[model samples]
Target: MFAVAADDCAPSDPTLTVQAYTVNPQTERVKMYWQKANGEAWGTLHALLADINSQGQVQMAMNGGIYDESYAPLGLYIENGQQKVALNLASGEGNFFIRPGGVFYVAGDKVGIVRLDAFKTSKEIQFAVQSGPLLMENGVINPRIHPNVASRKIRNGVGINKHDQRRCLLIHTGYDEERRVFAEPAGDKFL
Candidate 1:
């Protein structure tokens, strides 16, 4: 991933360094995996790449959002239209437990970011991963996200363009020295 766009916010303003990776599932095979199809953890990206045959170069690879303390995906996970881990709705501490946690999914020729309850009846999903405290929903920022909050955690998030609603936008930001998950506003059009 690279800086697809830089913000126009002045130098004196609160800052964040951001990079975005855009995925078009139509021409790309976007799938989630924690292990091999045979049900063995591939252990490393290199080993997984070696085991599975793919066409063309891998454009991007990223942490599949917040996982459990053991590093397992903490919520719903779907790969290639197959349900792997069921959606988690339990409440507790940490980012994953944040109320209104949602999922980023790819289904048929579509991509979406959906809230927990709304995701229940979704069908034909090709790929999906759940993560907490949605950055934005219906163009409104999550009420819990305070740009001035003391949390200085650099976090990554997935979203779909509102206007076009086609591509999946993967964003990773520069570290927040405080080391906890938080959010910041990216520009209207990230170039």
Candidate 2:
């Protein structure tokens, strides 16, 4: 996964930040990178193939998934024991306010997705981000999201197996223009 950010300077300005993570869940290995905007090339931050273990699990993780016009998180965002952005309670427009939008959170060794209301009362949350009308809930696709929605857009989300807490799923959907259909779900493991 990759993330890039730039300051509000002119196009010719050289103030940017880029981060990339290469994760191999099957081998439990991770690689990271950092690059500045001065035309400097990417630099490895964690050159070693880091293992994901109880004693050395990832210290922090961010969605870097989606955002809004103002570049603010379009959904819920929590970091370092603080709610950086409150659970969105307003309604009307946008994908985030769709009924049943959920929040993904990590607390201790546990990771979960819960409805926004449930999140308000949740305890011990270490990191969190809210996004979307759930893509799936209780093993079923969210009723509000239809396969033939007006627009076909790329989407991504996180899910956890109800019977296996250790197994988390990251899903990304893209359209195969040639086939005129969404591509098969790409699944990735978390930690």
Candidate 3:
């Protein structure tokens, strides 16, 4: 489910450019290399996980990141054994439908999408463990975890339906209850 692909170039030289790709299956491990872009053969990049992914996501901070109540809009590049960077970012909310092959789409942010051909529409639904704050139930919106629906810090809210559908919704309001929507504008309207 996780992988990285980059141009064959010197790491110390930024000009040796590489736009990380996440679709390569061979880059799943901590260290790997490719004979060419889109090549069928891959060599080795390194021998240790610590040397490559020691700092976790390349663009992520060592102390604060997606975990432990920290988050950001920037896509975190988590590397495996090689310096292969994969986009590790959060997902958008609203009207999400996972296709039979695990293709997922949100209400917005369609310009760039990642597809995973693993989800089955016939897969059995199951309950999932939750963390952080609960947004609302019926009419009660709990703030103990998020404190306010308008908090820019909490971009999404977690919830569970009566039928047990674990959901995460985009918070349209700010911590002050003001109409402060996030996500990029799709065509003309902000999502």
Give the top-scoring candidate (lDDT): 1
TM-score per prediction, in order, is 0.74, 0.57, 0.21
Give the Å shift of residue 155 in candidate 3: 1.3
Candidate 3 per-residue C-alpha lDDT over 101-174 given as tens digits, one digit per residue, 9 for 90 to 100: 11211211111112233222221211111122223323343233232334333233222222322222212222
lDDT of 1 by residue, 72-143 (tens): 777888877777789988989877777778888878767778889888645678778888777766666677
TM-score of 3: 0.21
Candidate 1 clash figure, as a count: 1
- What are the per-residue Cα lDDT tens digits for candidate 2 across 88-156? 767867676677778776665566778777776355766677776766555555567655555445544
Ten residues in sequence with the least summed lDDT for candidate 3:
95-104
The model with the greatest TM-score is: 1
TM-score of 2: 0.57
CA-RMSD of model 2:
11.9
Which TM-score value belongs to model 1?
0.74
Alpha carbon RMSD to native, model 3: 15.9
lDDT of 2: 0.47
- Candidate order, lDDT descending: 1, 2, 3
